[model samples]
Target: MAFADACNWINGNVNSNLTNRNSIQAICYSDVKSQFGLTANHVVRACARVAANRLTAKRKRRKVREFKPTSFDCDARTFRIIEEGYLVSLSTTEKRIKVPMRVSNYHIGKLQGRPSTSAQVCKHRDGNFYIHIQLKSDAPKLKKSKNVIGVDFGRRDIAVTSTGNSWSGKDISSIRDKYFRTRTSLQKKASQGTRSTRRRAREILKRLSGGEKRYQSWLNHNISSSIIREAIATDSIVAVEDLTGIRERTNQKPRNKTERRRSNSWAFYQLRAFLEYKGIKEGVKVIAIPPSYTSQTCQKCLHIGTRNNKSFKCENCGNNCDADYNGAKMIELWGCSVNQPRGSELLSCDINSRATESLHLPYRKCR
Candidate 1:
């Protein structure tokens, strides 16, 4: 925008020397108007953009810098600079974000990723300042292998992969149960009496719920990260179940009628979304197959209908395996076989492609 005009110079000049918030620099607003005769506002905007870009690049794990027009051979010689559309302030060094928020510059110079025509920004609830830059490009993903991984979706356990790997859905389940119990108890107490103490209890419960939501957000991040990491280690395509029609297919106990409305809630959708993005980043392909009979099939012999007890033994194959692993394997097979729709029990939005919506994951909603 108007502020983006001076970025060309700022890209080279933005450093510890330029940012003297207390002590004005030689090239302040007056200098921009007098020296280059540029918009006084534009100079600062460009400077901030440059600063933000520098900081963001420094922080990046791969350190991919914005695509400088001068650095590449392209048919397009230059990109237009956007006004106060989007901008940020980044650390001159140390790869840190020194600014909590900044304006946006739509103009084009050099950018690190996919370029956008609109403004973008990111804010942190964590107290740390961040230079928000929306990289239009996504992190590159690794190639997916043909190998199928069995995944078991459990109620008590979060998820157990066919390869004997497991991660706690503990955090997720705890949040779900904790929220249910505390919220229910508080409401009951309030209903029993309209005392001030009950009112305070209700407020406390509300805060507790916020905490629970935050925990779940973090939990989903952890689970997705773990799943992607595991997939990377094995170099196999993660096979998940086609969860389509899972709701009508199974019975789940809820706390009460109201809470049942959020039955699927945030956990399941978060896991899948995280996995999808992670898969793209890591270059792993995720596959979905029919979820039917995955739990009943024996991993050892691929025998079906052998589950007679909690500790499953293949009736036809004589294979003894952990019931969890068997379930995960079934999910993997279903993931590899076909695409399924999400179950009716899932209340959250399914962000997956039409094909992946019902694909089962190794994780279970520990509700």
Candidate 2:
């Protein structure tokens, strides 16, 4: 109740111009304490959280919505790990309470000696509460290598590497289609069925929600782990396309209903995120290169080529190969260039030019 009140207070007071923590606390500290009866520590943390959220939304150019009380932030002063790491003491509006956490071997190992200064108390939809402890540690030095492995992402083949490794998206696509049909049927029944049938349908729909997303996440984790292991084995840098704004850019073009759904459902960003964090933990260098024309350029001759479906053929060099594999090779070359001192200058192509059918010149190294 106290957490919810504090969040609501912060949400009501926060705005575009007054998102600074110190400034907001200066203005609303007295009001928060008096109105919500939150402790000074809770008030401070709530104000800081709202400010942080606003800053993130601003960076992403997203709208600031009213904050929900699903979670609350805590600091060292408000929370502490106790009972030899099995219990956590949390400060609440009523009083300080010690809660015993369900411990796993993995959790014990991770929290054995780490200093956790902050945490967030979250309420899961499953009606259970969980605390996320933030542990800080020094990052390992990145592995340096001249060898580069590029990964190309697409709907047909989820990920293809320069080393000829590929994960086909056929199974995933079929599973998604099945889920889509099931959801459509359930939604119709939920709206039009008899009372008992509608109730059952709604319950099933609720249970089915997030099933596909969880599967996608699990698959991405496996794929990223494999790619990172490959990079570690060969001592190579991992290079992927900088797909920022890709969905928005592609959505502008006309497409059929199924195509649009598949395109929107692609979890390439999550895969990239997994690769990045896993790389950081494993000390691998994961970098992003220009994505424009990667699939249409020939790795053998560095010339713009004709791509048909899954095949790419370079007229200039007469090089023919799998389109995704060729793109991965070109990405590897681009990654090599990016690693060099004057690499950016060598990649002088107009990246903003979205002309796909036009005859654009290829990238060339400076003499």
Candidate 3:
């Protein structure tokens, strides 16, 4: 009720008339507090939050929509963490309620004996309540490394590293296929005549989707951790492809239905994000470079190559190599070239130049 009132106030006054939070508060505070039985502080916080959101959306050239039905924001001052991080006291319209939280040691470590700035209380589609807390911490100083490791991300092999190691996507692909098969069966049942059968099928479908998401998240965490560990062991900076606008690009290409579905469902960005934050915590540099021709360009000769399935055959040098491994090497070379003293000269050097020849020496072996 308080959230709806705040959204109403913002839509009616602040967004429409460009009025300030103070003016809006003066106009609606008393009425909102009286009608919703909310404290004065809650009303003020809600107004301020809505106004701030409006300002941010305007700056970003985005349209600000009203709050959804399932979530609400709570100011840090209005909530208290007590009982050794096991309980949270939240303020509501009638009275304060203490909610028990099942927190892990990982979360406790992240808190680091400091209170969170604020929290969002949300109800998931599966009918579960969750609290997301935001905290502030200083990042550790990055460690300097003399080596660079390039990572090639793909659907067949989840990640291929310059160190001649790869994480396979077989398990992830199999799980996705299994989910699709199960959902297809459920859909047939859902189209039956009985209402109860349809309702049951829908519930099962929702649960299956949630389970698939959790499993994928686990796989990504393990893969990212292994990649970071390899970089730390070698004291190397991690280089990856900047896959921005990849979905749009993929959508533009011609593909069959199954291939298109697989392309759209892959979680490349999530894995990248995991690598980035984990890299930061481990004091390793993770950089993203434009993936213009990382796969098509030969890592050994820098010549254009034709890829047949997983094999890459260099047109000029006749060098045969694994396509993903070759891409990883090119990414690594690019990383090294950009970090050198004469970076631009190295970057724009001809494929037959002495500098390019020397750069190929380190990563010439085929995996």
The parts of candidate 3 lying over 4 Å away from their true place are 1-27, 48-72, 83-87, 92-101, 122-130, 141-144, 188-192, 209-211, 315-318, 344-367
How many collisions between residues are there in candidate 3?
Answer: 0
Give a tens-digit lDDT track for model 3, residues 1-367. Answer: 6776666655665445453778778777887777667777788877776777777878888876776657677778777777565798898887899999888889777765787888878898779999888777778888776588999999999999988999898888888988888989999998973899999998888777678778878988998999999988898889999999999999999999888988888888889999999999889889899999999988876776568889999867778989999999999988887665665554453556543554544456688
Best by lDDT: 2
The global C-alpha lDDT for each of the candidates, from Candidate 1 onward, is 0.55, 0.89, 0.82
* Each model's Cα RMSD: 16.8, 6.6, 7.2
Off by over 4 Å in 1: 1-132, 138-144, 170-175, 251-266, 306-309, 333-367
Q: TM-score for all predictions?
A: 0.54, 0.79, 0.76
Error of 1 at 155 (Å): 1.3
Better of 1 and 2 by lDDT: 2
- Span of 10 residues, lowest total lDDT, candidate 2: 350-359
lDDT of 1 by residue, 113-189 (tens): 44543232223456543432333556665564556566565555666887788775655666677688888888888
